[model samples]
Target: MPTAKRPPKPPPKPYHHGNLRETLLVAADAVLAERGAQGLTLRDVAKAAGVSHAAPYHHFASLNDLLAAVAERAFGLLAQALEQAATEPDTAERMLKINDAYVACALARPAQFRLMFGPLLARKHDYPEFKVAAERAFGVVLTAACAHDPERGPELALTGWSLAHGLSNLLIDGALEGLPIPVGPGEGLARQLAVRALGVTGAAA
Candidate 1:
């Protein structure tokens, strides 16, 4: 005798406790990780989220809006990581650790990292929340840099951030796989630079 048909699966709820907005953001982040920014769209996010195509519209006005929200979430997470990384009392060592945290956070969420810096979203200036989150994340680094040198804090922060960002991308893309030096987030040249910036040298470095 033929077996009876299996029961149908339940449809996804439109929102869980009025959290479709967060649900959409989570779905968008997953889609971006799985398929990159080019593949992130409201319909796709809805499909991934197991929600109706119209569900995303109820939360995000447009793809750019969703993208900004996703980026904003990433920046918030990065800021938290940076804040926690400054635990060591030694300021120079703390700076390096913060840089390492920044790199590690990027490596942990490479897709989000790219989205945070990519041009797909409308200029961050147009998105107040996005701008605040980005600045707050950057402020962590700036705070450390300014403490290292009040006269040149902004420039130093940019230099350090640029180094960490480039290093993260290189590692994420597998470009640093064969380097002869022992690889690390902020152990070598990055550490040296951090120490030098604070005028720490030799054994202290």
Candidate 2:
């Protein structure tokens, strides 16, 4: 008689329970915050999650996919922040709040800030959700700018974006502290520059 054969053991699971996709996303953000976007790797994310190297692939096809997910969430939050800022009744106050909100959000999450705007995610457009999220975030500022200056809304929005984006970069790099500007704070400087560019002499008053 032949010896009885035993069934093979079941393959290990990445996680025994709970959502693996959410776990990978959380792990990816930790790697991003620790290593920065340029140095991030899917394998490192898997390690952060205590999973196999190939585990990230189950949720994200590549590093870009992971980045897209991260950026999308960041942008969504940014949109909400700006929307809340836009609720100020006074126009000048609204502008100040908008700039404040933008910079505050960036300051609160400097790691995600870099990844969201850096060239590391050149393929971000490949992800529809990411693009939609980005547009919504930008639309908030654009709406505020347009409401402030209807005739040159598009141009005003671009100018405001240029100042805000540049200001955020400077603030992140710790390069704005010594700047010789009349404004008291980085966000104030952003509003002043934006107001000047928007031709709002009264607002600057």
Candidate 3:
């Protein structure tokens, strides 16, 4: 007449109900950092996130969708950094600030930075809202370029955008590392040279 033993309980699932989208995005970034873009996969992200295989699909319809989201977030951050840099008392200073900010943000977020400038997201060029946000961010440089020379605003804007964008990409690719230079130094030097060339002054460093 031995007593029967109680049944053992099943272990609890790992995922919480909230924040799954953010979790998936973070996992995607980690994978991107570790493996670059080629090896990224939704199932792999879901596994990294400690969620069910179907969980990531709920957040991102496809791997491209996830990459697009990552690019969007990176763009948002780039926009904020530009805006923050644009808070100078004068136009010349504002432009330099925004330029510097853009370079800094790229260095800080190289993975997202790469995907933003990379060719994958180029397929979504038809998306108006994406174009709009991109334009607004570009406008920061445009405004700055105009400040440098109103008559050459359009040309100068393109120049500034290309320079800033190029500088950031180079830094992210490690082409500019260990050169006895700082992130803001080259930008500051460029500003000084521009000011000298354009006969302008009064930008906050």
Candidate 4:
């Protein structure tokens, strides 16, 4: 008599269904928020996602790939926020909205923020998609800046970007609060002064 054999069991899936890429990115984001890029690892993310250690490889070949994905998501969100901010009527008002939007986005998503702007993941040039996404996000601010200063559009865009980038960096690093600028309802006094220096007038008198 011959014995019958049973088929092998199917492999288990990752914790989340339908969107493993997003799950890995979310796990990576949590690692970034808590331990930063240096401390992040594919194994750690896999563990966080309750998947096999090699499961991440199905979506991201290496840690940098996962990181680039994180950056791409961040840039998309930033572009949307800035675009919305720039929609305000007055140029100054629009600029102010953009300024606030940048900082708010960073604060709201610190992990994504660090990945987008922090030096820890400084190999941005190596990732073309990440670079393109970054440029898209920056273009939002540049457009608003140009709209505010048509005569010197390019320079104005750079100036506004510098000011907003520097301010966002400072706020993220806790340096803005220590600045000597006035606070409270006059919270944006420094930003107003900087915009004026770039020849962009504030809202109507």
RMSD to the hidden true structure, all candidates? 5.3, 4.6, 3.6, 4.5
- Note the clash tally of each candidate: 0, 0, 1, 0
lDDT per residue as tens, model 3, 1-205: 9999989988986656589999888888888878777777898888888888998877777888888777777787788788777777687777666666777787777777888777755765744455566667888777777766788988867766777777777766767667785544555655654455444565353
Clashing pairs in 3: 93-203
TM-score of model 3 vs. true structure: 0.79
- Looking at model 2, the pairs that clash are none
**Model 2 lDDT vs. the true structure?**
0.78
**Residues 1-205 of candidate 4: C-alpha lDDT, one tens digit per residue:** 7888888889985455578888888888888788877778999999988777988998898988888888888898898898997889898778767776776777677667867876624777888888888998878877877787776767777776777667666666776465586543222643564557576556731
* Residue 80 displacement in candidate 1 (angstroms): 0.4
- Candidate 3 residues lying further than 4 Å off, grouped into runs, are 7-16, 126-129, 147-149, 177-205
User: How much lDDT does each candidate structure score?
Assistant: 0.81, 0.78, 0.73, 0.75
Model 2 residue runs over 4 Å out of place are 1-15, 120-122, 179-183, 199-205
lDDT of 1 by residue, 21-107 (tens): 888888899999999898567899998888888888887889988999999999999999999987666666667888778887887
Q: TM-score of predicted model 1?
A: 0.82
Candidate 4 — which residues are off by over 4 angstroms? 1-16, 119-125, 176-190
Sorting all predicted structures by lDDT, with the top scorer first, yields 1, 2, 4, 3
Residue-level lDDT of model 2, residues 1-205, one tens digit each, is: 9989999999975455267788988888888888888877888888998887887788788888888898888888998999998887666567667777788888788999998887744666688898888889879778877787777777777776777778888888988676685446666666676666655543334
Which numbered prediction scores highest in TM-score against the true structure? Answer: 2
